[model samples]
Target chain A: MSNKVIKYILILALAIIAAIVIFEFVSNNPDKRPSNPFEFNVDNYKAVDETLISYKETRQIAIKDGIPGAIAFSHGQLYLLVDDYLQVILPGGMEVFKRKLSEKPNCIAVDRDGFIFIGFENRIRTYDKVGIEINLSEVASDKSHFTALAVSDDLIYVADAGEKQIRVYDKKLQQKHVFNGESGVSDVHGFILPSAHFDLAVNSDNELWAVNPGLHAIQNYSETGRLRGFWSKSSFENDGFSGCCNPYYIAFLSNGSFVTSEKGLVRIKIHKESGELSSVVAAPEKFSNGTKAPALAVDESDNIIALDFDRKMIRFFEPK
Target chain B: MSKLQSRRQFISGCARYSLGLTIAGVIGFSLTNASSQQWLWQIDPFKCTNCGRCATHCVLNPSAVKCVHAYALCGYCDLCGGYLKPGHIARNTAAENQLCPTAAIERKLIEEPYYEYHINEELCIGCAKCVEGCSSFGNGSLHLQIRQNICVNCNECAIARVCPSDAIKRIPADEPYLIKGGFEHGQTL
Candidate 1:
């Protein structure tokens, strides 16, 4: 072959290789590339509407440089579990009493007689009205990560998200029965806890209402661990629960309505006992973006109190 | 013809023929292997919704997903949108001032208005909090990508099962990573 022809062929090959390299480099550069249509943006956040249950923010109480964990109401007063301390406050936002605790408290419950039951990482500690700690080793287990606590006149229910079961105890704190939402309960498949967000609340009839977060359902179980009934609906609209695990926290009002709080969307809504959508207490725009799940509680006057974790404040909402 | 001339011609022909055959064989093998090889698990940053599930849904105690920074795209601003909160007043390393819950992103002062940020992969929980802040408020440089070395590559990834946005996907093994701000083609890490 002629030298001129050979030189032309080599130059052609080099040009092709350079074009391929440049094409690959430009195509792979995300900034120079076309924007993906599926990219999610936090700026597009839209708060859902407030329907049947309209709420007006009546008050806000500061937690004194602490993040609120769990909240409960007893004896016409609010009990807030903050960082290593339980602060007791009145309905008008006055500090009644405050006491420091040894272990970090995840959840709290108060009995009819004002006895406080605090749930730690793996055990339950009881405190009398006078702030004396009561030791209950029989009910304590390292295998449990107690995320929610509920006290009835006869039985004490502990919602263990770690073990995916509810442990029942008597007034003496003796382990009575274990309900995992499995076994003989045909309708109750099991609790689907994707994270440590499982919560439960006791209604006026002392029935256990556990938040089946994964399914976006509230399950009703008898004291004997029998699956009674449930109310659930899944939707992205304002009326229904949204996200993987929603309504992470639950509380019951005096009229048997449910006050629920969700995490990802960060909203509080009220639902009828039969799972009917009532009204929105606080919309997503009410709280800061990326707010964690707020602790929820309902007092006798039907006022909804939210322990805002992100803002570190205890806010009260009343029916308008 | 002389014997030496004939022998030289014969050897030249054989060498040219073998070179052609070798080139053809390499191209054919690469084409066939590229089509048949299985892909590994990867996260497409474009599809990720940052729902905070990547931190908890992984089979591992701490997820294999880690934040990767595209230095080429980064502005390297002293007031980094990813490192500081939206209304942060001071450019200090205080726990309350930083955006990351775990403080995984380390910031170094490069100059008066430029700072270099590095990700501590061990401390990252795959939450993508900083990525969200950076993308929404500043240059979209920081993003989440699954670390194949750390990922177990389960048949059905636990994170994929619960990912709300379905961002996790199986990509060709030849092109294992989907790095931002660069085109890798079918190159392997």
Candidate 2:
């Protein structure tokens, strides 16, 4: 063969070999794979428009153990349950009271009278302003997990995720009634808590709002277990709760707006009383991937107090 | 024959033997050791939707696929989403209370608020029940992977052909097993 022809053929063979090697490397390597074909991408829900975000993180108080359980804001005093201590810190960042509990608290709530109500796994313990254990109530049931607590003037409500019911107690911690969400109303879907993320909050009107996470709705029930009213939005959109269950925690502003925290695509959002999207408090970027939802509480000044569970810090936000 | 003809014949004989050895070496290399060039069916944990086909589609009676735990990514929650059934009342060892149908997962208390979970591959049916629960509620630490020892390594994987998520693909069998790297989507190899 001519030298020119031989050279061209050799070059062609080399090119084919290189192509085969490249193809094999790119096709077989997991890193070179394309974006997942069946990905459940709810990442778009994390993005928030600048105009819709009404709150900005102003400060963060890192807990001592760096492991926060739950938080409750009452009368400008921040009540944080971290490790085994119920720390009551003033608005000025001064810890006025710190009580070591018998065990780690699952949830915490403070009434207007400065009574701290702590919910353990299966029981409720109340401490008066003088740090005296006022009431110790054993929530009787095998499957009674006290996930959340809400205190009103005359009553205290506990969300039992295990039993999927709301246990109502009087001021003396006596079992008043059980609201199982089974009522004459046709719209009541009851409290469907899939995981352990059930939450309870008393709004400005003293109406108990329970997060039916599985239904992705906030339900309102009377002290007698009557379904009063509820607001729910279940979707992947900014206004709705997503995933199997969400809106892990919910609080209310003085203006009666709802502040909610959700898992999956972790976000802190505000909703109107009528369940309309008000504004974004903190978008998903504020949290790490696979982070549990932050515990939500609005202080006396309407400052949004978010206990970032993954970060182990208390982040305070204010309306823009 | 002339000297030149004898020399040409000797060179031709050496070239033929060299070519034969090269071909034999190539065949031997492929038969014993799977070189990097080989392709084997593997499930990408990132793309797997846990559609429940891995257990049924495999030719083996007990499917080769199994659930794996990424210890680094585990949250060690007392109420593990992977170990316990959804809306489970108590964290116990009851078969009905467990998420796994085969009861393959063994849960041991690590401390007050943490628990460690281990999967028994013998009983695991590759149903991906635990993987789905963990991914949805907790960290996506529990992921589905094909056990190489159990896999017969079929030329055409039955599961791959019908993977709902199309997560199963032919990967280089250089790595022992596909493990869930983390939330970042990194792979071991």
Best-fitting candidate, scored by DockQ: 2
lDDT of 2 by residue, A1-320 (tens): 99999999999999999999999677645466454332334455667899999999999887757478888887778888888888888866798888888987899888888898999988899998755677899755888888899998899999888787889998788898987884333564366544555788898889888887655678788889877888877665688876445788899999888899887668999999999999999988888875488898887778898888777788989977
Residue B124 accuracy (lDDT) in model 2: 95
Q: Model 1 Cα displacement at B94 (Å)?
A: 45
Q: Which parts of model 2 have CA positions greater than 4 angstroms off?
A: A1-40, A183-189, B1-63, B66-149, B152-189
Taking the candidates one at a time, how many backbone clashes does each contain? 2, 0
Chain A TM per candidate, in order of listing = 0.83, 0.85
**DockQ of each two-chain model:** 0.02, 0.06
Q: Kindly report the TM-score of the first chain in candidate 2.
A: 0.85
Write candidate 1's Cα lDDT for A151-184 as tens digits: 8888889999878888888877878888777423
Report every candidate's CA lDDT: 0.78, 0.80
Question: Tens digit of lDDT per residue, candidate 2, span B1-189?
Answer: 545567788899999999999999999988777544767788889888777778877999889999989887675655566777654545689877688888999888865444778999999989888887678666678999998888888988988876767788777767656776633454534
TM-score, per-candidate, Cα-based: 0.58, 0.63
